[model samples]
Target: MAIPQLKDKQVLITGAASGIGRAAALAFARQGAHIIASDLRLEPLQSLQQEVQALGVNCLLQAVDVSDEAAMAAFAAWVHEQVGAPDVLFNNAGIAYLGKFLDSGLEQWQRVLNVNLMGVVHGCYHFIPLMLAAGGPRQVVNVSSTASYAPSPSMASYAASKFAVAGFCDVLRMELAGTRIGVTDVCPGVINTAITASGAAPSMQGEQLQRLQAYYRKEGCLPEVVANDVVQAVITGKTLVLTGPYSRLLYHLKRLSRRLLFKITLGTAAKVGYL
Candidate 1:
């Protein structure tokens, strides 16, 4: 299929300071989109602004936390007041930590839900209406994960959050059925980023990084790959968007062999000492 075009459009990306968000910001900028890059990390957001601006596209940097609904509303309003309503909103801000459900503290669980689940909720509540008002060429890109397919022992809380996001995005897509707005869940397996380095926030990749390094790392992917996929999905309005081959395989297995895959997953986890 011919790739859909996204030139000269306004795009907003949360979690744009690092990892997939940064890559998405840069990628969209390369496509001639006006970029609004946001993250809790102001310094990195500023750096990304500089870098993308050097690419000769407009970039607005905002240090907004997606978990906060009030702040998200304010951020959207600011975008309207400044960069204009985004043709695309990458609701990509989230965090993860490793802990079984029982072992996870209430604080950790709430934090995870706030960012991973409620963050998406807040973004949708705030942005989708604007996209509807704008009437066309609008997209909402949510960063989910393959873990959303089922329960992950070590990533119980994190998986729960993603599951919520995936389901929520699905409903959002349905509700926007006749509208020009669309939703795409960006589910990626693994990508090489600082998700493992020191001081990494308790987000989706934080806890899994150590285990991947020990046993699961397999040729990993680049964030740019997901960024490219996001652009394609926005243009094509694909319901499900995954980054790598392994991710697609896992997705297929989830649909084709739920019981068998669950058993094998447990068996392999036990073998690898992850269970």
Candidate 2:
């Protein structure tokens, strides 16, 4: 199929203040897409708005906590009043937790799950109906992670939330079959982002946290790489997108041999002190 044109389109992106969300905002702006960038931080959101406007495209910044259902509903209502339905909705707001399940408390799980999973839920619950009602070519891209399929030992909360996101996207995709809207699950592996620096759980501290941050700085792919793939997925209507080599490899390994993949993952988890 011919790639869908993005010029003059409206794109809604969550967590647009930084990381993959920031990269995607700039990328879509370059394509002449009007950006609706939402995030929890007002200052960063303002900075992003300026950058997007510098690209000569319209950008509207909404400061919102994505985990709050009522707040998302309000945001969605505001969008309808100001911009009508978005042509593309990118559910990219998420948080990370970096400890074993046993070490973590209910509050940690609730916090991570609220942001990583319920945030996506709120975005979809509010925006998807509008997309369908508008009756045009629309796209929903839910940002998951390689951990959705490639399970690690200590990051149970993070993995579980991503897994839920992937599964939700799959079911939504099937439900939207034969419609103008397409649902895509975007799985990004290690990407160089401030998420590890700022969003890591308290349980990861001192040497372990430093080591984890160092590894990502040395080896993680750029967020722009994932942003580009996300754009492609929307244009080409991809159902599942794996952004990095490791993500693809691990996904295939899981498909080929679940048992072997589990054993290998366990060994790596041990070496990384994730056990």
The best candidate by TM-score is: 2
lDDT tens per residue, model 1, 1-275: 11267788888988888888999998888888889888886897887888899989899888888888899999889988896678888888877666555654677778888998998898889988877886786788888987788445667768889999999988988888777787888898766665534222233244354664455345567788888888888878787887853678778888898997788778866654345
Highest lDDT: which candidate?
A: 2
Q: Report the CA-based lDDT of candidate 1 relative to the real structure.
A: 0.78
Where does candidate 1 stray beyond 4 Å?
Answer: 1-3, 196-209, 214-219, 271-273
- Tens digits of per-residue lDDT for model 2, 1-275: 11389998899999999899999999899888999999997788887898899999999989999999999999999999999999999999988888767777778788888999999999999999998998878998899999999968768888899999999998988888878888889999888898876555556677877877776787789999999998888889888889964799899999899999999988876665465
lDDT values of the candidates?
0.78, 0.87
Question: Candidates' TM-scores?
Answer: 0.90, 0.96
Candidate 1 residue-wise lDDT at 69? 89
Q: Clash number for every model?
A: 5, 0
lDDT score for candidate 2 against the true structure = 0.87
- Deviation of model 2 at 64, angstroms: 0.7
